[model samples]
Target: MLAQILPWYAHAAQRTAAAPAQALTAPARMGWSTHVGFGPGAEILGRDLRGKRLLELGCGPGHNAAHLAKHHQAQVTGVDLVGLQVRRARSHYGHIDGANFAVGHALHHLQATEQTFDAIYSVFGAVGLVAPELLLAAIARRLNPGGVLAFSVPHPARAGRHPSTDDHARESHVTVSDLIRLPLARWEFDAHRWGAHLSRTGLRITSTVDLRHPRLDPWPTTLLITARTR
Candidate 1:
């Protein structure tokens, strides 16, 4: 996994440096998938976030955190594995009063932090990169009682397009305009499996939403799950 992840981190650093600052300070809507107009948005985290403490894992560029902080009045901390991404987040969203960014591995950050949060979330982020057992346990430890955990991952059904012997993690690559291919690994699990895993971690599954393409794709493109610590 290190062999695959190291290169992707380096590529991400280069891309982060070259990427231009977003014109919008905060997103108009927060969707689970990259597909526009698919799945529920920030409403999954609850309607009112005033005075809430939240943590985002693998918070690339920190738009979600900024949105929660700016519009919802939440105290949001966004952590990314890539240093450059965290730096970019601070540069762009630092003006926001309630949002902050840091660089660290998700599991390590959760385990090391003495603070606990009222909610934790990720959008196609560390939940897919790290082993579910380890990641879920770390998250549970850092969550306050009845705290929420929400995340999105590529649907397991999508894996049928690229068959893999290993069910836990699959090697994949992202192509950017046929110029750059960023190699990465993702762990895909259906809603049933996710429910079982979350239960074992002492979290109760509250919601699961399958995000399909607007064109009516046969299989869902993304899966969003929300759970709460017991």
Candidate 2:
């Protein structure tokens, strides 16, 4: 697993190093900009996240968490399954007042935490790593009442395609145990399927956004879904 996932960490580190040094000092925002280069300015969590206790489910390299803690004033705790990623985050932002990083499975953190968060979100992170049913079960218990659970997953419509495939509507599904060749083994589902899964997990579906770039085509779009615990 380490061999398969390390490439992703390397890529994240490169992206982090390539980002402007001043971005960490940029304004705080909620939600996620899952696509590459979309910017945090396009937050999906809406405009009311400041000072809230926020949890990032799969905080890669802690850039977003650092931004929230430094710029948004959010009391942020980030958890990543990858130890290196956690190290990267702590090395960069551990000194920030309201920001911390933990290396563990998201479900473990949720299961063990006595403290409930005001908001919980993942950015192309845990939501794509774990099974949906299991992920949502923990999320429901960890989030405060009426708190937000927002996450982004790859657009299912584009998974496993050659990009030159004539079929634009083709879709695929993978079980949690499946060996997927993608950087992260993500299980993709349509909006209706996601709604059904979230409903069963005791989360009320609030909204979903299709993150399609106007200039990009023949590639999968990113899907951002926002829900709340029932």
Which candidate number would show the highest lDDT if scored against the true structure?
A: 1
Cα TM-score of candidate 1: 0.89
Residues 1-230, model 2: lDDT tens digits = 56435555665555556653231432344445545566334255547667889899888678778877887778899998767678777777777889989988888888988989888888877875676788788888888888888888776665443321221223333222234323434566766777877888788878887676666655546778888877
Estimate the overall C-alpha local distance difference test score of candidate 1.
Answer: 0.82
lDDT of 2: 0.70
Clashes of each: 0, 1
For each candidate in turn, the TM-score is 0.89, 0.76
Candidate 2 clashing pairs? 31-45
lDDT by candidate, in order shown: 0.82, 0.70
Worst 10 residues of 1 by lDDT: 158-167
Which candidate tops TM-score?
Answer: 1
Model 1 over residues 1-230: C-alpha lDDT tens digits? 56645754776666675787653487666778868556687888877889899999999788889888988899999998878778778887888999999999899899989999999999978887888899999999999998999999877776356423354777766543347776777776677778887898999899998777857677677888999988
Identify the runs in model 2 with alpha carbons over 4 angstroms from their true place. Answer: 1-31, 34-43, 159-184
